[model samples]
Target: MKKNLLVFFCLISVQIIVSQIRNVDGSLGRIPRRGSDSIPDNEISVKLSGKTKYTDYKIISHKNDTTIIDTTLTIQKEYKFNFLRKDNFELLEFHNQGQTFTNLGYDFTNISPFPDIGFRAKMFNYFHIEDVNYYQVPTPTTEIMYRTGMEQGQVLDALFTTNFSKRFNVALAYKGIRSLGKYRRSLASTGNFRVSFRYETPKGQYTIKGHAANQDFFHQENGGLTPTALEAFINDDPNFNSNRARMDVNLSNAESTLDAKRLYFEHTFKLLSSKDSVTQKDFSNLKLGHSFTRDSKFFRFNQGAPTTGVFGEVITSSGIDDKTAYIAYNNELFLDFNSKYVLGKFRVKTMLSNYRYGYENLQNSTVGITKNKLKGNAVSLGADWNGRIGNFHINASGMLTPGSGRLSGNSFKGEAFYKKDSVFTIKSNVEISNRFPNFNFLLHQSSYDAYNWENNFVQEGTRTLGGSIASKWGDASIALTNISNYTYFDENSKPVQFSGDVNYLKLKVSKEFSVGKFALDNTVMYQKVANGDSVFRVPEIVTRNTLYYTDEWFKGNPLLVQIGTTFKYFTKYKANAYDPLLAEFRLQNETEIGYPTVDVFFNARVRRTRIYFKADNISSFVLKKNYFSAPNYPYRDFVIRFGLVWNWFI
Candidate 1:
């Protein structure tokens, strides 16, 4: 009977798992200042002071040019000037001797034909129509800064200021790049637009964003495995490529402080083909959260909502497979001063939720079907406090959940913050989390076409510790960061072997300097990544640098240039090869693609509105990483975004 009921729900879950895409115009956040037009220098003039002529004014002819002019006028007063070109001596700058000008009082320097560069800059910061172009260095996270804006990678992918009407803030962008002897990239084209707006509907802060993009592309990979290896492989699929109609939309409300009704939804759909053996996955859920307190000091806090976590990948499962769906009701409650909260400045939060999980391989024949109908319940309670004084802040918390059957464990976290000066801040933390096994982890099955085998999901626990130091100097800055984590796998009840963990350390610094009318920025980052298991995706050592220059030397019309590069060195994988049970070794001279390697990269962005150009993988240094024992590949050559961007905001 239990197996029969589980089979029924698994059949119905397929309908909810269908793939869907949503609008993306508002995927990024609000447009910021540090706007492209900001001048690094502190001095500039911006004001309108030209001759005010009145025809047939109450005339007073001062004898010659020697008459001292001392004048003051009201709204209806008039003034006039009449002189011949030859006899008219150029007038010097007119000064507003009394009433101050706009913010940061305008400086009135006595000079001829007011300094052009200094003149426009004075008001540049106050003007409308600000945009950003984003371009950046490639890292594991794939996050690039907008260069033309305050950051990198922002130049070519420009977004504009708020639409004066307040309905939506929108902009247009184009991204492109080049590499090796060949240059290919997907352009933002004309439909690349992002918009965000807010309204007061008596509910909460209302926000909506829309993004539309239609990008064309090329083959994803060019090279192939050796002929002998290819022959031995059973299933060899072609590279994956497609022009997707990608759109993402987000809406939420958090307007009034007195209101606690918030709703958020985000969807990503692809207008693509299942030819690459695509398996559709639908991601959807809703939540309602609120906060309550007594005497303005939060004692008990709770929020309840319907949430979901899913894994949907596109693969040819014989019929229609590769989808895992989780639908659960989640609730969290916390207490700052509990029943004898234990410590002063204490706080606690606990979470309990029930979920129905389902996984199915589309082509279910015999070995294709596996199902588990289960429920997950977790409770987490934590507390924190600090001894505030000179420059020290310390706190800590612990949480635990003993699940049904074989699922149970406890976890904890501790954190601290120390500041010695205005320029420096130090942050540190330690975390340990235990995840109990469920139906999906223990009863799910999928065919591994890439490796010609079968794989199953399992339970695991993770522990992490790390922190960073942020320091600033002038407009330039620096940061030192470090993080390490370890993971343990579970078989039936107890732990078995160490799965994998990663550690990374980095030092990053950057500065902006101006040469003539051009602005330039230089930044460099050095990072080291280490993996305990043979699951190698992170790099041993990677260095990245970016240079940016802008041509706003003259007002309005400007030119921008950004260049970036990355260097990496990898260590051979090494395990206790001598120990038979725990054997692992770094690939050597005659190994596969996962062997130790070196790579370099170069990317650039240059633009001026509707017209722009760029290059990615300028050097074509194929920096790649190996992910698993079957010798999986993590490769990056270059991806470029370029073309025309047409947008106007009113």
Candidate 2:
């Protein structure tokens, strides 16, 4: 571990030295001010004061929200500098990178309208249509992010985007990681590649946008520590404290993998044109659009030799291999009308979807062969409305597929927002949906006798209503949700559904205070399961607090520095146990795991580069050895890590 750390730092040092030699105004040195004295930088720009400004570099989302590029240092940025590259306040990660995370809370508002292929644990790093971004930049833009892994590996995410003309733009990105964990027989490697394009006609009458993505995740599973190993870890034996690889694990040669590929495109053409800009609000226009999508995914599990004690009895002790696949295709056509009479833009769409998911052959074990596949077609109709009234903006969408097929269901979601500049913003939303569980819960196949099953279950229904207030004072949100026919895995790793309805409530608040060079940021969440505690569980309270100092480092303010220490804690609960075979968490009532963690970090920004250095789980050294991410899986130990994010324009 020490040698790997030294080599990683040396590579970073070499890059910094090369950059210094290539440019006198280096990132760590004096940053050149934007003025006429500066020479032409990228070929796309003549001068910094020209029409091409920082705001010209745009990032567009699937919902058509546009945000400009921003390079700044803040505590929020520090929290997002991790494996997932997002704020994981509601998640607890395992000891290694590229591994799975335990759920500390649930958010019903983000549920999907349709069921997925299952294996939610492996999908954390997966990229969906909404997760991809389209770029429109004045010049070629590039961003590179690098981070140190657990023992002998690293992670890198790189992106590059450029505009060929004012009407056409293209972007490419790839993220890959390889991590060899400190534990025995635990290794993870994953990769994702994406390319997107956006184009429009000269008259802006026609537009098209699409992307292609390929991703795969592979992880070697050791199940967890053995009984003797668990005892040694809990007792903090000196012999095994520093040498984790010497410990015993449940499975010696077991692995799991997930692979996926997708292709999508959407095009629109305007039928009515109006050149009157002053009367645009009163003018009417009509547009026609079409979209097509195809997706293929599969999950597989392999074991060299089955362990009867760990996974029950298997059909054969020589070896075990299990695989399942899901393939889907969707086509949609829509018409949009923009008029003053309706007070908003209205759209009506019709979609046809086809799916096939299951194994290639039938199971001949004691479970018996029921069905080999679930293949069918679903037709759906939907409508959307978006507009504003006075100082408020409203958006709503509803979709229905009326039939007795597997995909037949209905969903409706609506939101309203009112904002008063920087003073405050108030928002409210409601979502209701009825959908079937994932494919795994319906049908699964495995070499192990206890892992194969097929069942007919009713559609699960959920409704969530929430509101929030965001202002200079703080940000707070509250939500109430009710669920019927909730499906989950039992302690024995079998699919099950709760008979009664479940009700839950969540409250979250965040605030930051600054005084001079010192600042404190805090976030807290409270949750309650009004009913169905036996089926649903979460910590009663979770909180994170940070106290940091910020200041300009040099005379010319070329460097910005922030140093902080964060403390996080959650109440004890019977957290769900992990099942690597299915990549799912099952119900557990034996042990309760919850504890506090402390992390210290020093972050700095120099021009377009941001550097981070952190000491995670610093309190673990002085605390007890009872910290566990799952039943027998221990949490991360004290370790120091460093990484950086850099951006360049050409």
Return the top candidate by TM-score.
Answer: 2
Worst 10 residues of 1 by lDDT: 251-260
lDDT of each: 0.27, 0.86
Q: List model 2 lDDT by residue over 1-650, tens digit each.
A: 34334434544554455335332333232223232235332212323224456667899998779997666788989999997899999999889888998999898986777788999889888999999999997666677788898887888887778787988999878788888989988898888889999999997789999999999999999999999999999999999988899999999999999999999999999989555466644343799999999999999999898878978877776877888899999999999988755778999999999899998987446678588898889999999999887679899999998898888999999999999888999999999999999989999988788888898999999999999999999999999999999999999999999999999999999999999999999999999999998989899999999999999887767788999999999999999999999999999999899999999999998877899999999999899998888888899899899899987654
Residue 573, candidate 1: how far off, in angstroms? 5.4
Q: For residues 31-84, what per-residue lDDT tens digits would candidate 1 score against the true structure?
A: 111123442222111211121111101111111112211122111111011000
Residue 553 in candidate 1, Cα distance off native in Å: 4.5
Candidate 2 stretches greater than 4 Å from native: 1-50, 275-284
Model 1 Cα shift for residue 231 (angstroms) = 12
Candidate 1 C-alpha error for residue 290, in Å: 3.8
Supply candidate 1's per-residue lDDT for 422. Answer: 81
Off by over 4 Å in 1: 1-322, 335-347, 360-371, 384-397, 404-408, 420-422, 437-440, 447-461, 473-496, 499-537, 547-557, 563-612, 621-640, 643-650
C-alpha root-mean-square deviation, each candidate: 25.1, 4.5
